[model samples]
Target: MMVNCCGLLTSQKEPVPLKSVEVELEVRDHVATVVSTLSYENKEDKPLEAVFVFPLPGDAAVCHFSAQIGQMQIVAEVKEKQEAREEYDDALSSGQQAFLLEESEQSPDIFSLSVGSLPPGESASIRLEYVTELAVQADDGLRFCLPAVLNPRYQPQGSGGGEGGNVQVTSVQVTSVPASLVPYSLSFSARVSSPRPVSKVESNCPLDPLQYLNTEQTQTTVKLAAGHKFDRDVELLIYYKDAHQPTAVVEAGRASSEPGTLMGDPVMMLSLYPEFPQAVMSSVASCGEFVFLLDRSGSMQGARMKSAMDTLLLLLKSLPMGCYFNIHSFGSSYEHIFPESVEYNQKTMEEALKNVAEMKANLGGTEILKPLKHIYSQPCIPSQPRQLFVFTDGEVGNTKDVINLVKQNSGSHRCFSFGIGEGASSALINGLAKEGGGHAQFITGTDRMQPKVMQSLRFALQPAVQDISVKWDLPKGVSVIDLSPPITALFQGQRSLVYAQLTGQGSEASEGCVTVRYSLAGHPSQNQLHFSLKPAEDTGLTVHRLAARTLIRSLEMEKREWRGQEDGGDKKKKVVELSVQSGVSSAFTAFIAVNKGNSEVIQGPLVRRNVPTPMVMACGMRRQCVPMSYDASPVMNMMALRQAEPCSLKKRSLPKQPPRDPLLQLVSLQKASGCWVLDPDLAAALGKTSEEVEKPKPASVNQEVWATILALIWLHGFKMDAQEEWELLAMKAVSWLQAQKASCVTECVDAGNALLGCTVQKDVLGL
Candidate 1:
């Protein structure tokens, strides 16, 4: 009954006086707005400064921040980060209460919030709001994840210093407390509405039964169930009947803002979901350079390591023949499966599979950038499109730096990224896919990684969409400016959002149209949306804030690209300007609030408190696999990291975890040629003895061909519900048999079906 919490920086042994957290989430279509109110009370004998470093969704844009201390309510304003920091420090020195919120330069998703000079017996409430677009999951569900702030994010070596150092957050030791003795409480609620009917809402946490707000089922409300731990991530998968419907929202400008500015001008958020023709989608390309980059970091122990091995099995078997492929595993350094890219035929695939089976979570630390450089440095094979598949736990410290590298080499290949566990950095996963023009998938909780990884693999095999353009067709004389960057690549059922500024005056009744055109393989496709120029009152500043964030990220990237140039500072200035204008939090800007009304003298020295990363449960007992805290200073933090033990989880008293997946056991028996050898392992995976399974083999067919047939029938007949996960593997097996042109395939299939107690037809097995 111990809840996990991310302990913050504190001068004292006890944590900060955080009492409760209240969250309200609203989802309209694919966009979500979350408002969190944290209640704190100073129960200490003296004044305390509370600095909390926490995680937010990587792509969320903070648009509002404020604090309520006693009867005084102080609204914060966005300013330059340094200026805000100085003001907060100055306020604390003056013995006045102040609040500061700044995004971490090391990772945009990590934010530092400092509440200074809270006198004893005083209470304060902090309100924070942000908006983000939900990512589509493998099953067409829109996924929204509230990350667990308590999980440790491993900092790469030589990081956490200088201007954008990881020094802002220093973890302190904290222990698990029973639920009955917990210091804080959490309240969470969500309201959802979409153009399509909401089919259902699911979460890893227990939730109250969803209540429909309307008969159409488009509107509903849900909240966490009673006694929820509020630990781990709160992941919600919202399924809709027709989620791909194209829609547009035009939000009204702020009444008090300048007309020419981002906040004053009406912003149109157009959503385009293109469903490609099945004819094109069904045709998988036979040629591509497939590079799989894996994280063998020590943190990928236990369940994570097993998940990676299972996913690799699927990926290795799913490769199309004649394609070039290689496997790279990285931690402190990287190792490759081959000297270079090799043709994925019988011989090469077996060598790769054998080596992959021997992989372990022994590599030292999470050092992703090094291996990425190695992958990108390789020259692309001629006549083969480069498709890079990266799998990681996303514990790296340099999120932006890694993303920038991906962006620089984006033109060379498409990168499909998979975040492997509960705490994967959404920023890293989303950024890689966005910049590399591919798709991103996340595997969380007990979810099978194979289906999601296989989905991305399918996307990688699809013909690339090129020559993309967004055409604005607004009312004449009412000019428009596109706030979003150009369209990159579009996949079936994925939502593409385009935000634009409507500058010139237009008739309220007049329509504004936008069209997105792209070439898929050789065929041209276009999707368009038309909306009235009249502002949408209910939407308020949601669309505008989202637009501002898009522009800010682009500017930040530009600022990085132009660094050391004369215009570098100018570009940075523009980013700060826009951030202030739109009232959105950015890397260059922070939100600061000061309580000028407090006139009390200093009670004690200022101290900051953060929620400590909690001790995780291990081996069915309350134990820690590694140190959960570091020194609360930049220098000491680095020292702690260097001295910290790798999480090999080598506890002497603990039993070994079952690593091999049951399904993977079957997949592991697959030969490089996609055929299963008639062995005891194969029979065991089939839940039979070798003597029993071998009895059904046709004399004309070889052992491998018959074993492969039985595997296909087992997958189709018994595991049809998991078709998506093993569809490619089954296809590979059938292809191997088809290559033999064995007329006895029918006899083998029927006999294998009898042995496996499955009545699967040969056609159903895709033979």
Candidate 2:
């Protein structure tokens, strides 16, 4: 059997053989020996600088070391450096005796351990005494890399333990540094060829890279400015059955702007919550109304709901007995079992917990807004911080409306949404949290739901910042040009700091400071705190504008889709105008926005009464369908001209669903107040007929198809050839959807509208 191991970086070299390796089982008279020696004759013509990588436990400590080989000695010390450097250094330092090594006199940097030399044809031996403080075995491991050393010849002895005994490399990491830093284009690859077929592939990359890819199918564009610096680790894994093909790569370079405009609002980039410097066992007193709005819809009936209920129970049990709590169950209807401020006595809490456990998924519709609004409307302690946790798959009638309600109803309370399934709407949950000045979390896998939800709830309930303000006290000559809204402070563990982008060049400054102040809930408060600053080293007017514009485009896209108007319905209404006014085609607005680096724009109602502009008229198609076809665009062309960039549109799954009338089949899939088709392909499948098979619309559309339509409208407006025309069909389908039992809401009208009736129903049900 092959012992498989995994690591970060990888290589093409064979695993070193365990020559004369010994595993001692006994430690007698303090003369214990655990020699795990591996030797190999240098077959290649280059010296070997082997880095013995180890995945030591976080609390592991090296005690002593002894090595015998020539006059060469080893060096070791505790490294306190960036995590990246620490990993690299740890691998090289492992196995070398601590006492005999050339131990550093000063505190170790991240890459601290070193061995001077193991000359060619020279054998070296070392003994190390260390103990790992980890309570669990899984936390201990080591990793290393051996690069070709000075002028020497050697080939690492492959795990030549027969065909069945292949050398297994553990904790391997193959990475690439930027060419700007390394001046080289080195690629890393790993091979995990075994007698058995390959089973799995793994990947790890930074959040920015993943966001750039937009794996969530969002039309959002992530931009990097010219002078701005960014570093990210991108890991790609390709698993294959063949030998030597388990390869991965990390690509890094200058990234240009993504096309398709999303208008952005000036926002606070970072939170300014004060860190709870020290935690003590103080009286964890609780006040205010604590509402637990649970998703008890039919979808939540299985392990999803079960896990959520158990988690909620665990949380309820853990709450200090002094806190007030309420339980609300929502589905087709909602039931608030307890009053707004239920006393948390032993009996009351136990009964509430029982009620929660007994609560079952009933009805179907997810009436989220009503419960949230109800919580907001209820009278409660005005000064105490209110917290409402919505635990569900986030399958709601109207997410936008619920968010709006929460925002509007916010008095002294915060709204937190917990998504409990893979299909949970990230946008909805995240938007709700953002809009409500709270936090949103998505919990996947039933087994992990309880722990994840509890963790999120714990943080959500802990307020780190309140009444936060960030002010830029500029120099004498400096002026305040523009700034985005200070973002709501989010808690990071127990501390919070706010960050914002300030744009304005100063000729000279007597003094400059960014002042931040916020209340720390149960902690202390401050006002007008100042952060001194100097002229920004990285200041690019063009890149800043572009970044701002790109953000605006993304926000606009989000808003446009939020207003679900199928059939290019309201395309003529310059409802929301991106600031690129001089463009010939509305589609070019995205290009112009990028070209000019302007982010400020107006959005509200695309008033139809506004003077009919040629661009709007030409592009005035509802459900702006961004062509899924891999074709050139003015924006792409502009990007190419500016930076020689290339972007390809991913192909649609239903290539044949476009041309044909999709309404015919769509109407059939509608079930009264229960099932509604959100996927365009499913709608198209429902719309198509056997007779239409000869000229069936390209493949059918999915929910993403509708999104693409909206994106196209954002770009070209309501302009498309007959073959690409699907707006009318979409309109018909939306009408059918509107008339359907209202379980489904398109990006057209938002999940909020569909839930309005549910809100009424919930109200009637005494939610």
Candidate 3:
């Protein structure tokens, strides 16, 4: 059989060699700790070695790796990358089983695992553990994604070696396949506990009904539905009832470790959702130089380009009247709408909108670095802070270089980035915003681009939070030993996590408190959280490992800053020492395990095989579309529009039967209370089932608010052209919207407009 492994087609002499995979995830507060166990068997009648290249969340910090063969278990230890590789090679040559795990130097999201010299018919169980901070979505849900697909990244010509000259391990092109066709099974389960009540949980894949463990709903457990194939990426969205509340947790360190060390002390994780005064929010600057950078790369050729254009339209229209703006589109190269940023007048805005409408993903490869350099070279407008809005599918391989550039220029501008589509590189999207001191958002299937873009626009316009500090109040004997880096910036409603080591012994009854202080619009504000000194339940080494990851990240940032300078060596050494001490894998270190218990030395040349992984076709596409060359003529603009027309016309046209008229259907589905409830009938008209819509909403979501919003969206979308036909219904919606101040009607309308591609005036709705 010929198998598609990565981008290479190879003939396989046996059935799919890789077997089942099991994943155990534990989420505490805003961080998630994941343990993956892969079971593989050597079915061939010879010694075999396997190489598997897989994808992980870009920010994951791998902390543990071990292999179990028969009854012997060998735990891996963190070692310098080169040394680990050499040791593994020696073990393999000496007829010993060895396992090595190393992260790709070029892309943080990719990792290569090698399991060597497994005897015939013997099975090996490989277990790996990692820790990462879950990203908060625009709707305030915490998102945890396990990447099961590794789409081949397009590397442009003349790009040279990326960051380091790390050889490309594998190129896996996404291919469409039915779930049943996949050869492997996946079993996943997660335990979620938060300071705030766990309202609900959602997943892209089928999941068993959630089981709450406590009446307060502070803890819950969920697992994958039975007989689930390893098909698409596994995504879980968790919502907390009081997500914005400030909370503190102190985790006890490892008891067996010596005192005065990271493992010996208690660690406190502080989560702060800073609420800036409304006056400060309203005082955001109305004058700034806004530069919009759109990705025209080939990977963004379909719905992504359309979404970008739509987002650009919304952003261009929302800019302050007196702000200056410019638009740039880049692929292999870049083109600008204007020679430089011009005043946001009617003429400029109209011209930019026209150009954006005609924009297409004709640019060959994603070459963002050159254009970034060009943008940075331009002089900044006096007193008008530069804000860059980057829209991309985040397919670039030179992620580290791009982020470093953004970091170097952080002082001059703030960056807001959007990652388009499912396979978008989280590293690029999150790194750009993190290094540039701004915000990041990801848009996937059916996600309205406008609301997220507009939210980012509001963030860009907000005044910078300055003079941030954290103060600790504890008993005299208790002190903070190692503290994470100081807070660089803060935005309203965004949660900031701070990790610190609480050293020394204090009475369990003592009160420990922390206060976060920052300046907003020249006004000083502080948020204080108090907790007992008593250590929380034993979470093993989760807190310590998380703290180590934080410190390692800070050290890596410092290394980037000292890239070509003399201090680089010292920073590298420190990172290595910290990684080794904590058993966490870093850029300079890897995890290696070797088994020496085998009494009989069976020496033979092991057949090396690369294990294949299932590919996920791009969202909304049925087949993989090959990107045209850089010099190819532009086709995506016309093609996309043509393909979109059928759907548009279908949506606009009423059904042949009056009973099926979408507007009438929606009205018929509404309750006597004048709100369209999320019922099965209404969901069917919207091309979804009620269960799908209702399952994701937590107790925090007011059904009335959501139902009203849906009804308004339906009216604004399908009935806009025939308002006379539904004016009575529209009036009722308007009245209902007015009566309910519980929801932000204006924001809802904006979100609806963005999703439906309509420009409904908020003033018309009396918002």
TM-score of each: 0.92, 0.39, 0.79
lDDT of candidate model 2 versus the reference: 0.35
* Steric clashes per prediction: 9, 88, 0
The TM-score that candidate 2 achieves is: 0.39
Error of 3 at 675 (Å): 30
Native RMSD of candidate 1 (Å):
3.9
lDDT of 2 by residue, 162-188 (tens): 111011112211122221221111122
Cα miss at 320, model 2 (Å)?
Answer: 1.6
Return the TM-score for candidate 1, rounded to 2 decimals: 0.92
On TM-score, who's better, 1 or 3? 1
Best by lDDT: 1
Off by over 4 Å in 3: 1-15, 155-182, 227-229, 282-284, 617-767
Candidates 1 and 3 compared: the better one by lDDT is 1
Ranking by lDDT: 1, 3, 2
Candidate 3 residue 344 Cα shift, in angstroms, is 1.0
Model 3 poorest 10 in a row by lDDT: 624-633
